[model samples]
Target: MHVPDGFINAPVSAVAGVVAAGAVAVSLRGARKELGGASRSAASGGERTAPLAGLVAAFIFAVQMLNFPVGAGTSGHLLGGALAAILVGPYTGVLCISVVLLMQGILFADGGLTALGVNITVMGVVTTVVAYVLFRGLTGILPRTRRSATVSAFIAALVSVPAAACAFTLIYAVGGTTDIPIGKVLTAMVGVHVLIGIGEAVITALTVGAVIAVRPDLVHGARSLAVPLKLRIDGELVDAPVAAPAPVAARSTRTVWSVGLVTAFVLAGFVSFYASASPDGLEKVAADKGIDAKAEEHAAADSPLADYGVRDVTDTRLSGGLAGVIGVGATVAVGSGVFWVVRRRRQDEPADARVTETV
Candidate 1:
């Protein structure tokens, strides 16, 4: 949940800011390796794959708008960090979550502008790293079976949401303005989020499992486990297709792009109307424990896009729907453009001198 300004003290928020910045810095470097890795599947497209990455980000943003109920009056939205990291690469996933949080804070005024750093740290960095690590560990330790991947996805996502909640609690313990008991805060935050985590696990597992079924090659987390393209010589392993990887045809890219964009539009524009209107886990806890007493109103609350509605749309549903659609479009366009540029820039780099010389 987008922790608003008054929820966490300035010191805690600042620390989160630093943590978030550091994580982004690390991801920038890691992204190079993740994106540059070799692939065996015919779908292991390179630079042209950037548009798909963008679609993942946009889809995450759109689905996040549909907040599912946890229990009681509290609800939880799709953090999407784990889902993205599994679907796309971890670095790109971090970038994707950051973009969504930025839009939410600045455009929708949903999350506090001042607390943007904290949200990014707790929701983006913590979730992505935790999920990715768990996914990898499980994939390695368990049998290399399809069921293992789905099971791993479930556990990784289940753990990540509460881990984020615990992180927030720790931050609050350090910089909490009020004298609330740390134990109570921790217990409450973790307890509520555990339920939320179930929802997270189901959603992440379903979404990731779906992609892995269709295009496991497209899934960054699942890339290393890709089925090797071996020669069928008497049912024995042979030299895999290791040289000059096949290029991604333009027609395939167009198909993926179109389908993804359409899915994002439908989810955000129409499905969001039915999202739970109840308070989220954090909001419910804040009210129950008096943590919200010092909460400050967001400065951008007056913006036209604030609260997910256009400025002058007469119908509430129409306004919110349009805003959601526009948000999806904008997020997709920006994310895709940024990723395309990054992929292209990397493409332009000379192939590794050592590898080239060897070849």
Candidate 2:
């Protein structure tokens, strides 16, 4: 849920801001190893990881625009934390959601500026951390097959949504500006969010399954879990020997990247047009429960892309499509830059160590 300003008092919001900043800083450092392929294979390298991470961020932003209905006059969108974490890693997943939230807040004016920290804490950090933990736990107990991994992804995503909703409830209980009963708010938030979680689970499972099927090596969570290919040796199955590393420049992920970018474009530019117009779970609950009574205006309300429609573009479809495309482009560009830098820093570490040794 995108928390707006005034929902949390200034003091609590500031505290949340500090927490968010610290979380982001830690994630930045943690993402270097994840994106650099250090944990998977030293020979595999991470040149493709940077751009893939960027695409993941852009894809998440695009899918988030397609809000599907979850019954009872309420709609819910992909929170993307679970999906990103499953596809990438937990650290990179946090960065992905953070980038999406940042883009939405600044460009689309969807989330309030002052409440950025609250949204990141509840939506990004909580969902990613909870989903990753659950996914790992389930995978550890279940069969170590692709099917099992996909099932784990589904369960992880399903639990993560309500977990985040509960986190919001706890935060609001402590710092809510409204006088609504905390118990009622908690029940309503969790109830509607449970339904929303189903949608999230389906989306996450399908996406993770698809990625695992095509390129299991690219999926961070499934990389080490996938069973190696078997060879029939004298009518007996034997594990295939490890293949030699591909040339550094030969391991291009251009095909997957192109396909993913096109899918994101289609989803945001075309599919989003038919998305349910009803308020999302959080918005519906807020309006019905009066939690939004003291909601403050978004600081970026006057931005050219406010409300997901391009400024001065009267045609609804064209305006919204343009805005969505712009958002995807911006997110991909910014995310790619950040991840590329991280990857480079990781690559430089060994050389720096060598230089220090020589000195």
Candidate 3:
């Protein structure tokens, strides 16, 4: 959920800002390892995989716009933490959601600028940590099959939503500016979010399953589960011809990136029009429980693209679609740029330093 301004007082918000900053720093360092896995070296087992992480971020931004109905007068959308961590690494997943949140706050004014820390800590750190840990644990215990990874994604995503809700409730219990009882807020938040988690789980499972079917190599969580390329002849097994050459493998990464980017554009630009119009879980909860009593207007509320619509565009559909498309483009660009820097820094590090640093 996107916490708005004034929901938390200055002191707690500042603390959250420090926590968010620390998380971003840690994630940046960790993302370097995962992005480096995409190095051009054939021995690395991947090529330009960093770009795929950008696509994941853009895809998450696109899907977050499609709010599905979770209950009477309430809707929910993809938080993307579980999906991202499954597709990329958990650190990169954190960065992906951070990029999306930053975009929404500054450009769309959907989340308040002042509450960026709260939003990131709740939606980015908590969700990614919880989902990734659970996913890894489940994948470890379950059969080493593709289905297991997808199943893990579903369960991880389902749990992450309410976990984030619990996190937010705890944050509010300490920093809330309203008179509402903490028990009521926690119960309502967790109750509605449980339904929302189902939607999150379905989207995560389907998306992870589709990617695993097409290109399991691109899925970070499924890397260990990839079946060996083997062929049996004369009762002996050898490497199969299924493995592509290095050049072809590099080209495949580009192809996948191109296809994913196009899909994100389509989802954000066109399919988003069909999203539920009802208020999302957070908004509904805030309104019903007086959490918004002291909520201040967003700093960027006057932006031309505020509220997910273009300022001068006449048609509502056209305006919103354009905004969504713009958001996807910006997210891809920024996310790619961030990943590129992380990858380059990783590559440039002295071998001794790299070796000396603990992962």
Candidate 4:
């Protein structure tokens, strides 16, 4: 959930800012390894991974626009932590959600400027960390099949939403600006979020399964599950003969990237118009429990894209559609840029090490 300004006291918000900053810094370092590929020979994997990471970010942003109804005047959207962490790696997943949150806060005014740290800490860091841990643990114990990976993705996603809700409750218990009782807020937050988690699980499972079916190689979480051929020699199983490396085909990510970008465009530009207008899980809980009593106005509320609408666009459909498109474009561009920079840094580190050795 995007915490607005004034929901948490200034001191607590500042502390959250520091925590968010530190988390982001750590993720940046970890992403180098994740995106750079596990082996030096596959340094080119960065070439394949970087663009896909950007597309994932854009897709998350687009899907978030389509708020599906949960129940009782509450709706929920894809948090993208599970989806991203499963598709990419956890480090990159954190950055993906952080990018989406930053874009929403600064461009759409969906989240507050002062509360950016809180939103990032809860939605990006907490969800990504929890989902990745559970996904890894489940996949470890389950069969190493694509189906198992997909199932793990589902369960991880289901748990991550409630985990984030609980995290927020704890944060509010310590820093909430309102007089609401902690118990009431905790109960309401966790109860409704459980429903939201189901929606998250379904969406995550479907998306992860689709990707696994198409290009399992691209799914970071499924990589370890990929099985190699084996042979029975002398009544004992042994590793199969290693095939010589074939001539490298001119691999192109254009087709997959195009398809993903088009899908995001359709979801945000067309389908979002039909999404439920009800308050999301966090919003509903806050409204009901008086947790939003001290919520302040977003700094960018007067911006053109504030509230997901274009300024001076009288047609609600057109205004929202344009804003959504813009959001997708902005997210893709920024995400790609950031990922590319990280990838480049990864590429450079080896060279710097070599130079040091020479010296």
TM-score of 1: 0.89
The residue-level lDDT of candidate 4 at 249 comes to 32
- List lDDT for all candidates, in order: 0.81, 0.88, 0.89, 0.88
What ranges in model 2 sit over 4 Å off?
A: 37-45, 228-252, 350-359
- lDDT score of residue 55 within candidate 1: 89
Off by over 4 Å in 3: 37-46, 227-248
Tens digits of per-residue lDDT for model 2, 1-359? 78888888888888888989999999998787687734333533355566799999999999999999999999999999999888888998999999999999999998778889999999999999999999999999998899999999999999999999999999899899999999999999999999999999999999999988887777888866756789999999999997865554433478889899999888888888888899999899999999999999889999999999999999999998988899999999999898988877766677556345336
Write down the RMSD of all candidates, one decimal each. Answer: 3.5, 3.3, 2.8, 2.6
Worst 10 residues of 3 by lDDT: 37-46
Clashing pairs in 1: none
Return the clash pairs for model 3, or none: none
Q: Residue-wise lDDT of candidate 1 within 1-359, one digit each (tens)?
A: 78898887887788788888888777765554454533312333444346677888889889889899987889988888898888777887898888888888888888887788889988998899899899999999887766788889899999999999998888788877677898998899999999999999998998888877866666677767745667868887896767765555678658767887898999999999999999998888888888888899998999898889999898988998999998998888788776766665555556674245326
**Residue-wise C-alpha lDDT for candidate 4, range 1-359, written one tens digit per residue:** 77888899998889999999999999998788777732442522455677799999999999999999988999999998999988888999999999999999999999889888999899999999999999999999998899999999999999999999998998888899998989898899889888989999999999999988987777888877866788999999998876764433335467778899999999999899999999998999989988888889999998889999999999999999999999999999999999989877776787656345336
lDDT of 3 by residue, 1-359 (tens): 78999899888999999999999999999888777742323433334558888899999999999999987899999999999988888999999999999999999998878789999999999999999999999999998899999999999999999999999999999999998999999999999999999999999999999988988878888888755678899999998766564354567778888999999999999999999999998889999999999999999999999989999999999999999999999999999999888888888888777657643
lDDT, residue 45, model 3: 33
Off by over 4 Å in 4: 37-44, 244-252, 352-359
Question: For model 1, what is the error of residue 195's alpha carbon versus the real structure, in angstroms, after optimal superposition?
Answer: 1.0
lDDT-superior candidate, 1 or 4: 4
